[model samples]
Target: MSQLANIKQNIDTIIGADELMERIRAGKKLRIKLGVDPTRPDLTFGHLVVFNKMKQFQDMGHDCILLIGDYTATIGDPSGRSDTRPVLTEDEVRANAETYLEQAFKILDEDRTIVRYNSEWFNEMSFGDTLNLARKMTVARMLERDDFAKRHASNSPISIVEFLYPLVQGYDSVMLESDVELGGTDQLFNMLVGRQLQKDAGQPEQAVITMPLLVGLDGVKKMSKSYDNYISFNHTAKDMFGRIMSISDETMWDYYRLLLLMDEERIEHHKSDHPMVAKKHLASSLVAMFYSLADAKHELEQFEQVFAKNQRPDDMPEFQWDSLSGGETTCPLLNLMAGTDLFPSKKECRRLVEQGAVKVNDESVSDPKAILDKPADELVIQGGKRKFFKVLG
Candidate 1:
């Protein structure tokens, strides 16, 4: 394939085009850098969007550098936040790093990938060196960033440490002598800083590429743990399938185009011709990518049985009615989910209920105070498109 075609196939966005393509065609092993701050322990589907792109480059014989921003994470990235993030301790960052790698390996090849922590370089920098790095960018330029400008305009707190974040993140590219950098669209401002810093450091400018943000289950904000709209990599196959199924029907095409590895033409045709079938394929494709074909098939079977055939899921969690009833005439669904540990907290359960993502006995339940008066034989409760549990007495 031609170099441009190859680049297009692997990435959704490539900022520096002709020169980067020339480098790729020259048979030079491009050092592709992808940095993820271990702010959250679990890798969500959003992170996988970029990881999948990195996998494409690795498969194409490029060197993939996975930078775990342990050092910079301590400062906390203020990229898109409305408020400053609480800093994480070194121990906390290390603990999250272990799980980050374990989950990242689901898409990234351990042998072929280079996993490095920013602390290795950042820790050794002297106070003088830190000042030199800080001087590489100006406050005026930093203010150009959307988040910074928004915070500044709104009289929101924009700490001096927040300004250091982009510089530190940019230096990661310089340290690796990166040929290309990848991140989500939200990271474009920071990624561009890498290119600028590289140029300022008398190094060849690294190409910047950004992927579209993966919308959460809410189909509004970016998929994030804080928003309670993420599907973690650590979830069981059943949970993963259910989470994918819970996505808004409107998001099916977007997920198919971004998440699944299906042919674009085929997916586009399916979207216009038969959206329902397209979504089924998308859901199955995503499940198969994370799990196996057999597991994906099983999920589809379960989905069909429960959604189409109107039957109970075969492997639902068992709940005791006596334990749930508590002699109360009616119980809030949020309370029920919390008592059963189906959700982490009543807040999340209430959010799920409000979104109309929760159902009981195959019927959508909106009122959190609805009575659970049905016979205790097999009371089915659904969290979203995929999560289901059966209560028995």
Candidate 2:
């Protein structure tokens, strides 16, 4: 297919496909905008769903703008929230913005891409300016958003700041005069607001393209850091490969299609292979994307050794026994697992132990309160299916 066809291949919807195509054909280097709120420290594969589309435009020689929502992040995007999002301090938002650019560049072209922070304009604006921007949208229009409508119907508390989120986001397009905007389907309302604001400003309205949200490892919820099922771009090669390999066979196909951008024919080609073979290929390909081929290869080898052969990983991380044991002669199994940082919390470690998910030296330890003797030699500990660590006294 042609590059233009490929641009619309996997998108959920495009508001102005014809106009966008006409501009592209007319040799106008369209300014494509993708705005992201740095509410979290890491960008997940879910964010990658839209970034891939942005990269497609960058490759086609359009001016791709990576709009960092440093200003909007303070209010938090209320697109999918049922309640008011917790306000973030300027310091917190700025710090997240720094890391966001680093992770975003993994998929986006750094040299050719144009970067802008909404703070550039928002910081300069006064309360009067915000009120003027707010006049562009009505209260009825703001409540028309699904999330807002649902909240209002359910009598859930909706903050006035939440109502201003779309208007603030919309003002961004007017300021930048974007030609095309890319986002996930959840951001459709906000993107439409941008288009309307652009039209009101007498600038050409931006064509909006919304991509599908990538399902997380659970195969249920959308991939998000809050869901704790996301694979972050900053994850180590081993963690990244292991997490991908752990996804269900059913979910692997989605990853193959969405993350790898494989067409249906290509997906069917992989589906014909044994599920394990297809999954390993998917894992290796994704690991290689953020990291090197050698890193992916090494992780694959370690994965086989640990899971297929039931042997310890060659690169198992080591922790000092004293540190984990807290200088005690014995350490509670739950505490030891939590100290390794493999589990999110001691409560999660306890749950895993009760479910027989924790093992010491390959022996299942089902009791959460079980204690391990401070080992004179290195001891291999496994937490859940994917984590392994060596504790040395």
> Which lDDT values do the candidates have, in the order given?
0.84, 0.90
lDDT of 2 by residue, 172-257 (tens): 99888999989999999999999999988888889999999999989899998888899999999988998898889999988988
Deviating ranges (above 4 Å) for candidate 2: none
Please provide, for model 1 over 1-110, each residue's C-alpha lDDT reduced to its tens digit, 9 standing for 90 to 100: 55456457536578887779889778899999999999878999988889888888898889999999999889999988999999888889999999999999988999
Worst 10 residues of 1 by lDDT: 1-10
In the predicted model 2, the residue pairs found to clash are: none
- TM-score of candidate 1 against the unseen true structure: 0.88
Best by TM-score: 2
Which prediction has the highest lDDT against the true structure?
2
lDDT of 2 at 231: 97
Candidate 1 Cα RMSD (Å): 3.3
